[model samples]
Target chain A: MDNHELFIQGSRVPDRGPDGDLMTLNMGPQHPSTHGVLRLELLTDGEEVASIRPHIGYLHRCFEKHCEKLTPPQIVPYTDRMDYLASMNNNLGFAVACERMLGLQVPEKVEYLRVVVAELNRIASHLVAIGTCGLDLGALTPYFFCFRDREMILDFFEEICGARLLYNYIWVGGLSHDFPEGMDDKILRFCDYFEARIDNELNPLLSFNKIFIGRNAGIGVVSAEQAWAFGLSGPSLRGSGVAFDLRRDDPYSIYDRFQWKVCVGEGLVGQLGDSWDRYWVKVLEMKESLSIIRQALAARPKDGDVREAVPGRVKLPVGELYCRTETPRGELGYYIVSGGGNLPERVKVRAPAFSNLCIIDEISRGALISDVVAILGSLDIVLGEIDR
Target chain B: MEFAELLGHIRAALPGAVLEEHPEAFSPWILVARAQLPALALLLRDDPALDFAQLMCLSGTHLPASASESDRLASIFHLFSPRHRHKLGVKVVLDSADPACPSVAGVWPTADWHEREAYDLLGIVYEGHPDLRRILCPDDWEGHPLRKDYVTPATYNGMPLD
Candidate 1:
């Protein structure tokens, strides 16, 4: 298939064509671009990959098994480990589900703090995604620039929450600690610096670079029907021209209060819903997250006890709840069932990476071996989140 | 639609499919008969009024033997319709001794992985699953670990738990 034909139409080459001369190549349990211990079995015809099967669970900690033993409050730490890149968003999702089970709502300050930290983490996570994607496709400098900005976000996180990587800061009912002195100004400064940095620093380095766009645009195309049928969410779903953001549609937390646009791929430089569109959506989402952070900072209450309504003891009613929030990667859902006890009966996590990664075999059928790396990088699957 | 209105719509379309409805629960849900699940799932997706374009999550829950009933395993499918922006929770209860439910992987592409995960963790055998191998756990792992009566093995493949 020609590049022009493939760009207009999604990859649909035969599974075992080209005289049936196929060779199998195993990709990674430790390869650099596989992201985190994910292994792929590739069926290749010459240099093009005809089929791909993903094997995960190298990072399996059986988080749901762990949650079965821990209480609603105690499971917060485990949630952080699922998607370590976006620990605040992970903690916020589990806490929201547990709070719904107990029917608890925190003060307005707590809500604002949650939104601020989560949005900041979204920017940090997307930086890693965009940076590593460039690195995988042979660009070296953008990765360094991406990590440099990410370091500042981590510093802000360390300032607010003692732990840098896994905060465990967001509790079931409220935050573990309120914002410390002078925290608002520091976050706003970082936000101001990042808003300008994206266009000047990121766009030229990777976003609009000729080689980068050539490698990504129209490589792994996912149609709108295929996107939602396969349960793709977050940026992956939006990349296919689907404007479904849970924060906007479902109205969770304080997201409805904010005024921000959902970034959908417009085929600006390539065919809509291609790998470039997916990568571009993450870049645009970083700016939207900054807008949210600034709005949340101004609207937040100056004086309020974040921990005033923190649950002292645990008592779950005999019922179940399924709550989902739009995490940086996608929709992170928690289906918690309580049998009138302190501990949960069942806790099933619907990790977005698991579903997003499942669509790999579908899109990578006709892609070349080199294109596979860019495709996987576009999907941005975290093995920890997938295997959990 | 409100929970009751949706429930009524479902009941009218597919009579004798729903076994129970809980509007008072934290998230209103309807218990569907095990045999009717495949049809019910297809209807939920194809029906324009109940256009559930996405199967958000499919979870397996093991309920141990209680005074009310014996050990039962339930497969819960959370459906979301982007068109209507409505949510529905459909559950199917199975016997823990022989937990088997027809797979809906053909209906919703996402169910392919989810059914495997549920089967791996809870041993809920999906009848028509294309590939039902263990997902998170090893293929030869002796028993389902999520069961209430699960006993962790001391060693596996000569590797000690310690």
Candidate 2:
């Protein structure tokens, strides 16, 4: 062999081997279930798994650095891309972080409006989670059903905000623009239609079906103790018997005025907290979210400023703060550090999918390969959040 | 709990680290010395009175404009205790010279990935992390991009960072 070939071989770089004991498989940089550009290296023992190492950062667009470069208003649009499925929630999160630091109090009307829009975003996000979960488990019918409902919600979002998927509608102090004319009536009608259809059509077809139950129930079992240790939050944690919902337990954005149940599983068809338990938690969460929307709509505020009367230039003080909210996936937290400037010095997002995805290595080790798909599907990971 | 109460609790636990309380906000924050971070975190995790067991979020932030080295490079850990339904925020400062802190992966295995992301993007090395390597950036990528003074290179795979 040539000297160059000898030198390259001397370096212990990993390569595909025909008879290797540990075969490495790339899950996705584009695979459907990854939710985004996440690629996981799965080391398996023929068919059974030995180790699952996540290789992330394919979509790391240096958002935190970019946030430092732009004015606060300019940065609002970028938050849309972070957790794209729940962009409104991401928008609210970034706005609240800045608002809290600045000690700005939003109007009551704005609060109620925020709750309505945020709840709609939450339901829309959960639909994607549930519909996509169904898709991963070899069911195609539910995707169309859930998306059909999702499209209706998106139509409402479009009427209120110009954009549908990545709506940067919620701005600092208040919404980018107040709900357009007749936005309230449209949202109310959508909520009523959603609430009725959930029980009649969506629940029976997706959550209550015998086939879905058999596929998800008793699979990807993560005990309550394990869930807490691994920092599982939102529906995944609630499903594991922890009645902690940030909207209820830790009220933010006028959530204290609303009443809702933190859904936990009694394991109707399985043990304490399996994939089915988590799956059902999302279903119940959507119902609770609809209730929240209804209440917020009823208590609409008459007159107040939606936008805060702050300096035209927005800047955070030279301090650090961590603000979190319950997203459809779990707890979505944003940690921001400012050096008393127009742009934040540092911004770190504690995405729920990252923590939720981490537990896969611990739980999926012993489950069958087919069951791994179910476990991952039930975990409801959005790779955009995971990779970011 | 109130901000003063959280400050008092943290003060009682870690006598070495400096504490700052912001009464304006609903929650209080504590700034611990970089050297005493792991011990302080251990105390918060182990002490029943301040059992901040759930590491809700561990993140890194750059403060390049801050005058003091104590504030320039910071890694914050937000802990939540479901048992008590209380939250605590902890911060540690790292200097630009060597941005390394003890790995909390031992305390929470999930920190394994979070710390790597911090190391990869912010250049804050979490020492003793079992699998400490570039997570979000390619192994050959130069310079941490999250630093305040970072200049985005021309292109990554022909797409400009801008």
Candidate 3:
């Protein structure tokens, strides 16, 4: 069957009249704006998109199947590969799930350290989101500025754990290693510098750019009802004016202790849940993450063992649990079923981007072909999680 | 309301729908017959007191061969109510011989790709899924990989495996 028949099965295809101007366009298994190997088949009449079908699985490495083979602790590195930008949060979600199953209580220091690293990773992930989003549109300078600030966060990550990109730092019960000497000072310094830059430099340059606002604002608006029905979470859901944040509403770990605002899109420049609203939410969230980091740093205990509760082997009892955490993109849930064995019977990942990406077909219809990239970048999907 | 109270309300609404309840399980779940899923899902979403609008996750599993029942394949739906701030798990056991269950895509549009993914990996068919093609694996690939009895083939096209 052809692409149209495959998507709109049993529906009659519209005729193109005498000019015959309708065409099907493939937007990337390789295009830079897609953020990874995502192929969007667009049915277009000239410049307007009639319908869009997203073809994924180019990066499917069988993550869930791999989890069934590996032990709980060994699966940390694999979770890193899902949403690589938010690896720490992914590790924390899996670690929290395993810890719940094993009934292990980690030290106070582990909790503080987890919050610190996860908040930092949240900033880093948003940097990539805002940066690439600017690039997806015509603005290029913001990408460089955003990446430059993001490098400092990566430097802190590299100092704490040996790996920069994918750190298996968060073990089942505790952490892989405690912070290195003077690392706390470095993190605080970076937070101070990063906050200033985000407010002064990044916002003025890209977030408030008239051209950027014109290109993004009032485009691809998802109503709160549609967003909730589609199961869009995190910034995407909040962008549509839903105030649910897993960190606050769900309240797992030490998130309740921090004083941070849940930023919801208010249609400041355009309609609520538009492309610009989603972009602005990320910008505002960076500041909220900084506040969370500061609180975590202040509350961190100086003298405590990070690896005190790290078990030699993680053997879960006969049970199952679905644990979810607020990652940068949305809610990353790990539905783990154990058969009283070291290896999980099944590990189903409810990837945020997977659900977030599915709404593209619904939203992209009737939009100009150029706004497609803007809408996609605003969603800030990492195909790693989508295809995993 | 507590999970037990929620289950009680469901029992009142749809009699004989819930086959069993496992309150002691880690997450606490209810098993529903395959025929009762669509009705239960509708009641779960539309009923204001038990509004489970969000279908958080849907997973397909292959039961171990040693299990007593011939209905070995299962699909689990994890539902959450953003309004009520409650969660529920609805499970349906399908016979391995003919692994099929009524699709809840009509109740929750988010289940479209998820049911497709479940059908792709574990071979549990969602009876009314609009497009039930393979999601992660190639469309023409043989056998569901996540089933307990599945064996890796030695070769694919010209590729060889040890």
Candidate 4:
């Protein structure tokens, strides 16, 4: 069937009984699409969902309490565990928080290198988000194509650092180690190959496909006003036609030097703020991140120091600070209250998943059960970030 | 918004409570009486000029005074304004004798889980939260560990609370 004809069809909602009533169902604390230990109690009137209550905290690791006992430098590694899909971006946030707290200035070369690695990590994260989003929509082939390029990024990560998934590469003052031998070429090659791969395989396989587009085009919709009310950041907010990217609005690093497009939701080409718009926004964002990565690499400085003198252990000032950054999902904010000692007085993480997931109870009020999974997938929630 | 002006706006809305404003950071911190939190939250949310509609985060912390056996706990509310691109922080001090405060779930539904989290971890009860069950920790878990004077327990439900 054509894409438009396919879009005209609705999800498979089971018919009610003689009295004409539906049943409620719990999807997870173990389902795939809720994405890691999330239990969504779905109230359904047949296969059509009446409401959804997301029960999180199955993976609550007490990360905030752990931050209380550790020093500023000690907390950088913990950010990795929150959203493991994009570890470098998490590391950058911790480093920026510590930098702002202590007023530490990194060198120009360090800034350029941080930008390159962070943008690369952004691309890697978007690949996973888009790939899995497509997988949730039943396009299984794109996962292989997306992960194939993602493996190249992981190879570059392993080359520079020792780990694949959780690279604690970005330290408090600067990077853990400078770029290894011929590291720049591998990254450049990955970027050059990424665009053509997305165009040929990933994009057409999902965004342009009839079934894929129909499943997601108008399934789950969130308006710009609702997006702001829910405190969404990153691509989830951008997917709702809001132009509020922290990278551009609140430039923490060398984002000012690079020029890239902020891909906002264009209504899924057929429906605005639908699941398809949310999914396609990330795919387009990956392309934009590649442009940023290219610019950051082109203006690279070779002979500058990547390390600075950060105190091994120091007490923070006796006060509180709330710092936020744009992560792969949305706004990941850290609210730390320091007691002017080795440990934080209290550390609270305003995770993106927690905020983004709040809107689910509103948006999924009348969606189909299958579309609820599609909508949850489109939100791109990580349970670690949600339950932290 | 200027830190003093923001505090002044909040103070004007709720006249009975004392307001504390600090200028060290761009975001100002407001100190309101524990009893006035719900009203203050409503005022902040309903006021058109300072329509801080979004509750970004709600967290509880330990007050660092050396007084033993005293209830020295503090709760902070972080509010965000998307229209103005600004943020304001509201905090209240609760004592051990009666560590209770009003809930903001009535104003913003997003505060429901956050308030329950605070109640679970810090033992600061939100008087008006509908379903105030343990959010992150076990339902039968005892003692708020996030408090400064919390005693470390060896075991809970036959497993180490570690």
Where does candidate 2 stray beyond 4 Å?
Answer: A1-22, A302-305, A308-311, B1-27, B65-72, B155-162
Clashing pairs in 3: none
Consecutive 10-residue window with the lowest summed lDDT within model 4 chain B: B18-27
Model 3 lDDT tens row, B44-133: 999999988899999999888775655389899999999989998889998899998999988898999999999989999999988889
Q: Score the docking of each candidate (DockQ).
A: 0.87, 0.58, 0.81, 0.54
TM-score of candidate 4 against the unseen true structure: 0.94
Colliding residue pairs in candidate 4: A14-A47, A28-A39, A29-A38, A267-A271, A267-A272, B71-B96
On lDDT, the stronger of 2 and 3 is 3
How would you encode candidate 1's per-residue C-alpha lDDT over A1-388 as one tens digit per residue?
A: 2554554344444355658798999999889999989999998987778799888888889898998788878889999999999999999999888888788888899999999999999999999999999999999999999999999999988989888889999997789988889999999999899889998989998998877887888788999999999999999999999998989988788899999999999887778999999999999999999999999999999998888988897777889999999998999999989999889889999999999999999999878888899999999878889997
User: Per-residue lDDT of A1-388 in model 2, one digit per residue for the tens?
Assistant: 2443344234324443567677677788788777777776777766666678877778877677777678777888888887788988888888887888888887788888888888898899989888988898778998888999999889888887778999888888887667777787888888888888888987888887766777777777888878887888888888888888888887778888888888997787777788889988888889999888888888987566677653477778877778898888888888877778787766778898889988888887745556677788888877677766
Residue lDDT tens for model 3, A1-388: 2432233222224444568577899999999889999999999876678899889889988898888799988899999999999999999999998888888898999999999999999999999999999999988999999999889899999999988999999999899999999988888888888889988999899988877887787778999888877879999999998898999999888899999999999998778899989999999999999999889988899998898889998998889898899999999999998999879999999999999988898898877777899999999999899889
| Candidate 4 overall lDDT versus native | 0.79
TM-score winner among the candidates? Answer: 1
Report candidate 2's fraction of native contacts.
0.60
lDDT of every predicted structure (CA atoms): 0.90, 0.79, 0.90, 0.79
List RMSD in Å for every model shown. Answer: 2.5, 8.2, 5.4, 2.2
Model 4 off-target regions past 4 Å? A1-14, B25-27, B67-69, B160-162
lDDT of 2 at B121: 84
Q: Rank the candidate models, highest DockQ first.
A: 1, 3, 2, 4
